[model samples]
Target: MLNDMSENQAGYAFAWNTPKSAINPYLDPPDPVQKSALREVIALYAADNRRHQKPGESLRNAVWDRYFFNADRDPVLREIAQDKLTGQARMARERQRFNPEQTVMDDIHAQPAWIARPLLQRIAFLKNLSRPGPCQRYLCATVRPCLDRLTRVRDDQTGPSIRQMAGHPGLEGLLVLSDMNQNQVKRLSALVAAHMAGRLESACSLLPLDNDVQPEAIRRVWEQLAAEVMRLEVIPPAFEQLKRKRHRRRPVSYDRIPGSLARMICTTWWYRRLWQRRCEWREEQLRAVCLVSRKTSPYISREMALYKREQRRKSLEFFRAHELINEHGDRLEMEAVVRASTSHPVRRRNEMMACLKGLELIAEMRGDRAIFYTLTCPSRFHATLSHGQPNPMWAGTTVRQSSEYLVGVFAAFRKAMHKAGLRWYGIRVAEPHHDGTVHWHLLCFMPPGDCSAITALLRRFAIKEDRQELGKVTEPRFKANAIDSRKGTPTGYIAKYISKNIDGRGLGKHISKETGTSLRDSAEHVTSWASLHRIQQFRFFGIPGRQAWRELRLLAGQVNRQHNGRKAGAPVLADRRLDAVLAAADAGCFATYISRQGGVLVPRRQYLVRTAYELSDVQNKYGDRSRRIYGIWSPLTKERICTHSFKWKRVRKTSGGQISPGRGHLFTPWTRGNNCPHGEKINAHHRIRVQRKEEETIKDFKNEHK
Candidate 1:
């Protein structure tokens, strides 16, 4: 029948109409249990395909084709079908042992959505529903309440038996809780709870052999506690280290630990705090163990650093020798062009300073008050104390996690301000703490009357977590200072931070307060930290965006080129507002540009000029169409001006007096004169002719002398 039908019809018939016994006679017919499991699997497969399917595609057909028609050809699909059939067969056998009226099939069908989820997700859901043991019940009654107050996770969400939660992939390898008794589970639960509550000392006290816990059990519990509380993804080096030294009964001391284990412990708050009490660590030791160690930071490795350095070297070499040639025969050397672009560190720093100064000037003219605020993450996010000691309150949070926390707080603060109808403008600089936690320095300008309200809202969000630890003073978490012009300018206040995070220029011999190192020496580490965490270092809000500013600058350059060295007036822009913005950007006056485009309070849609983008002819590396900014569009004038009129390509330069062995041709070296309207082919031909004439003259001279 299949041979008589077309391929599509055969596929459809085999997928929908054919029975399992028909396909393979030895295979038994699917019972209700197996059929239900198959349906669930097919339903999930269809849902997943629906997410990625095109508009007119049928998910039903796609699922059938994938599971039935293609199963024989595709190993993955065949394995999945076999696994579902085998698992359902086994489950059907187990269902026979239970009541015939209420089988596992009924339960599976009752929550098909839950059954369709991944194994780990299902485990997490079941773990949450599982009843708590005695120790977990105690923690839920005491420790969980405090944690609930501090974290977004509610008490109900954190519901116990933590032994069941051990099903997490990260914890599965560290502990074998399946064989443990009630006493062991109670002890492990209590220890994890104590560590979570910043009570590592109390947890350690419970680890003594006198508590009726086996030495091996204590070791496993400690490892599990460290892994879970610190949120470590991999088995800690301490586990293997302790295994190698199984002869010892007590837990290892900090000084006697391996560097990898030491780094892990020092990077976590409670563990670091416990170690500090046991041993006095010097600043150098702390730096060596925490800052310099790469064991914990996987995003940046020695290989990656070497790769980046090599790439930088090649980029510099390429930029130094090559010239970018446009379709109009216009050429610009790549090095000079790149240095002027925003990606350059020095250029970016200068632009940021100019933007800040511009905002300050505008604020002064409008009678707005300048307020400098330092927003920090809660104590739980910090890894170390200010004096280079481990913070007892640190919860083993990573730099990326802390950065995200600050971003969330700032977002909330912005939302609150928006609701309150307050307008502000300024720059925010994110820099890492000494221990690699990120904090933000925001220089904001707001009306004098609204300053207090804004500060209050920010303080409320910044200290929302671990508020009790903040005590009576919240300055350590959220600090606000009115920029007093009598002492120094607002630009001066933030300049050091900006330079310290960037190139650290003009900061002669100044030391960083956080790291206690020379600002110049520590700047590289700060930059690496930011890069490793993928954090945005600087952001400007309540101003015309940087893209529009850059485009305007390009337009101004175009206008300058149009009338360069001529005795004619400069070309006029399409609109008066456009002309003003172009002039301001040309003059490097960010304040004027901001005002002409739209003041700090105006929305993006209301801006006089905006960036215009077009879909590219080529797809990106991911095989998706990407948009490229090509020109500027003026909303007021209803005109679009294409600033990028010519496409440019980088060409390698040939050195002077160089001859290729294959062709015996003398190459013309690239020079400013040769880059003019004179074509490169003409120059090369002329140079070849001159060289040939010289060679003939030399031959004649040699013959006459002979």
Candidate 2:
């Protein structure tokens, strides 16, 4: 407006560079009264322009557009005007965005930034190691006033559950928080970035434990971040100690229900081999990009040429420099890796149990220490460690070889027990001696009168009748033990083997970083682990041991009710994997028709028992809500819903709602209430949980039904 008036009317223009003499570049002193009179004339003159007469448009913009020329003598002044206009337009747009009709997650930014990201994601990220995804709508009503306070989030405070969060646009739904007057978007962004770092720490740590992620500790770290929000120059080191504190558990608890405890060398070898092997290709890719520039003399493959060609198109120098600095060394401590694995201690235990149970069984015969029996295989199906190796004989045997033979022995023993109607307990342990022969050691509590008959049957199965077929069946002794009374109980003699099998207490340990990689590799590459994969080294099956085991477990369960929920018999629809697992856990002990019950044993329904420590497992990942309610996607409801039990959480396939969302659609469980098309609010009955390996399957199912 000034430029137009200055050029056309010569009234609005003032000498910008003129000295501040308060004379308005004129000879007369332009006092406030005089300036006001002059501006009134110029304003009227500028308003006379036809271009400023746009109807229904902003008068200020219309006036400015009429007088403000794109090209003017003062470029700086024009630029200033342009900036003012842009700022006003942005403010208007921001104001327009807060419309109650369209509640966007970003609109909360217009209010304040101290809001917690969706309560669900925040809780999961803080505790469950859930992936950091899009943050849910902010809890503005609950958070706005607390921003300046020193109070902590109250756990008892009710907030939207994960289901509610998923069903609504978070902050937009909070009408009461509309009047909040503050800006914390920058602060909020920093908080979320810190959360992302915390998640990364959880993933990269050597071990991620729930104990290390205490709620109080997390709150303290968050408060620290909040206190220094203004001073944060970059992403503050979030959850740094959480990462530092994470490491594999010492004395890995047996309550974790490990399937095997053997071959520490192979286990560690495999882990390191994978870790180092992963870095190999990454480092090679860097080298490939680097070598591309120096590819004059070397002949490369066609695939290699194309890959290098592509790398050239990218910023190779930048990537190569970073790769060179971060590249892993070519070698690693092979033995150190194995020595640090969960399998190390277990290996000792397995080997000791493999050697001890048979001897202990023999020693348990009525204060006896000398009653022992052995079943030796005469033929060599595989070679042992004693056999010279270029190609070891054990390599030819499969994992099932020993297991199959041992299972046959169980069959014969069970058959003998049935005929004699004996309630005697037995223990059988198997191992391959250095001579490449698999042998079984057995101990059975039997009356002297019945011993010979059962012993004869055992010998028949122990040493196959075809002696010539067994290579050299020399000294195929049927009775190798004489019961000699020695002590009050023989269990101690055998208990040592059990202890060794669990922890390898007496076994010598060897794994060294100084050892050559080839030597370590060779030691781990032997066929022993694979051969024994399918075999159970020790077996116990008898009335006495089973009864006592059940009694001890039941007693333990009774003592810790908090960890072990009541042994309620849950109805399983067989929808999810836990149906069978939990059902077995709820049952007692079983009885076989062949074995007679011992006087000390009670008649109980046989069911598999699991320890409290072993019973902890989760099927639903994101479905577990903040209120301690667990959830799963209900196929019948076509949406995620909360359920108390894992079985109830499964999707119900047979049932379908009559009042669908139209067009063969289904409604979410929460939406089905109040506004239902039916007479009464119909419950969205959940179905057998559709067991899905990937989350996408559940998502796709929901989408298809919706």
Candidate 3:
């Protein structure tokens, strides 16, 4: 409008000379204050157009747009402006009018679109959060408070129980906590809080045991009262100890009179009095000897020596007449010596019985002069010397070979004594190796009449075996062969052999440094490159060194040539190659079975075989009857071939659609007593894929339907 008015009035306005800066256009248009402010702004702009307008005319455009409604406007621009203006007005009203207090209650009474949409959604979310039901929800609300107060409920207090008759008022759905006091309510609150915090069971476990109540009632209380919450009750360790303690009868009373006179005469001081009397008798014998020596002097001493000699000779003749002494003058001692031995630790019951039994045996058989000894175990020696010396023995086998051989030798001697029907003795096997041969130094106990028979048996077994071995034994000497050569020097030759087999396999390449390079520096440099290559281009299967790789490739070429022998075609899976396949199958089958049983299955390492000969080699390597290498991809060469065969097929095809599953021959039971005796279970055996009866019936049903 301003532009159009100005164009018509341009000539007249020039005559009137209305200087645009002096006459303000807005002065007559609106409120006086707005008009005056608008004129002031216009006057500032008119004073210097250059000063008001920015170098890019940005400020001038902005000023005109804000102040003027007159527009030579683009339709798009005008429409955009109108929309912005309406939006601003609406927003302003909304911002000024909103109140939460009014909306919250108003929404309940008459839900607007937004409110109505979320009610069902909110219920669903809350219900999911609530879980199980509202009773759990309500119980959840009170549990914490109830638990806090539970501690204060007297230990004798009857804990809560739900008492509802079947088909009665509380039957279907109701929570009635019987015998719940205010304190229990507080405890319940604590319990609920714990439950909310995911410690409900733990909190219940923290409850004091109702020791004051009946044991049965206390047991029932946890099951019943704790039904609404999780609870753990700890049994006292003292109770556990008591349960494990051994039960034994009390010692028989010596103070009380017995029915039998023999038992009645038993008294605590009897042994003490008897020991004193024995000591007195020994003293008297010494006094009498001293008195006799003083009176007879040198004459009595000479006579006594003669008499002792004569008595010894007579005793020897008596033993000889009875065949107690052998022709070699070795005689069987009436009482045998005791020596250290080893045995398994006695169980508690055995130990008690042995103690009583040993005392009885000692009293009946052992004389006063005989010394009795119990064995000390090697285990005890091991414990004592653990920190000090290492055993010189192998240490078990070294000691055993020597000790056991001696024990066997002496055992033969003892057996001879026993065979003679003489139960009157002890024989001990002695320690130490004898003349480089393990032989027992026997101390035998035998009756005077049985000595000759025992000696003869001992001589026959030992001497006969000894003579045969001695006849063959020769002086020790080293035999030299064609061993000292470039190929067989001790260390160098060992290195050659070691490098070829498993002994050298894991040692990797024995790459040496070049003439001018230090081994370490060369290794470091080579290692860096190898590591980079390993990360970048390396694949599983080949040995580490370049030479190993060449050998592998050569081996692979050889396999390929052999495979080509049968004409080029798809390679057959070999035993070694099928390992990964079988492993995958086993793993998958196990995983599926476990999954069905509500467990998880972790997949095994590889899923396929890249080389057939590899499987064949593995089957051959195991050497188990269950595993036969029938075509496997080789790990080294990556060629497939059948290196072996199985007597039975692993998997078979049936007339039915179902493929019979393979049994893993790889896993056989490993235990004694026929636990897993043969390859029957380990090796796969074919069974009918489907029951014939069922299959026939199904076929008949299908035909009938048709």
Give the whole-model CA lDDT for all candidates, comma-separated: 0.59, 0.35, 0.30
How do the residues 201-225 of candidate 3 rate in per-residue lDDT, one tens digit apiece? Answer: 4434655666564434333323332
lDDT of 2 by residue, 544-599 (tens): 33322332222223222222343455443233333333232234222211122222
Model 2 has an lDDT value of 0.35
Displacement of the residue 397 alpha carbon in candidate 1, Å = 1.9
Q: What order do you get sorting by TM-score, best first?
A: 1, 2, 3
Number of colliding residue pairs in model 3:
46
Error of 3 at 136 (Å): 95
Write one digit per residue (lDDT tens) for candidate 1, span 574-605: 45566778888888998898888878888889
Model 2 residue runs over 4 Å out of place are 1-370, 384-399, 420-423, 435-437, 469-479, 487-489, 495-503, 507-532, 544-706
Best candidate, lDDT: 1
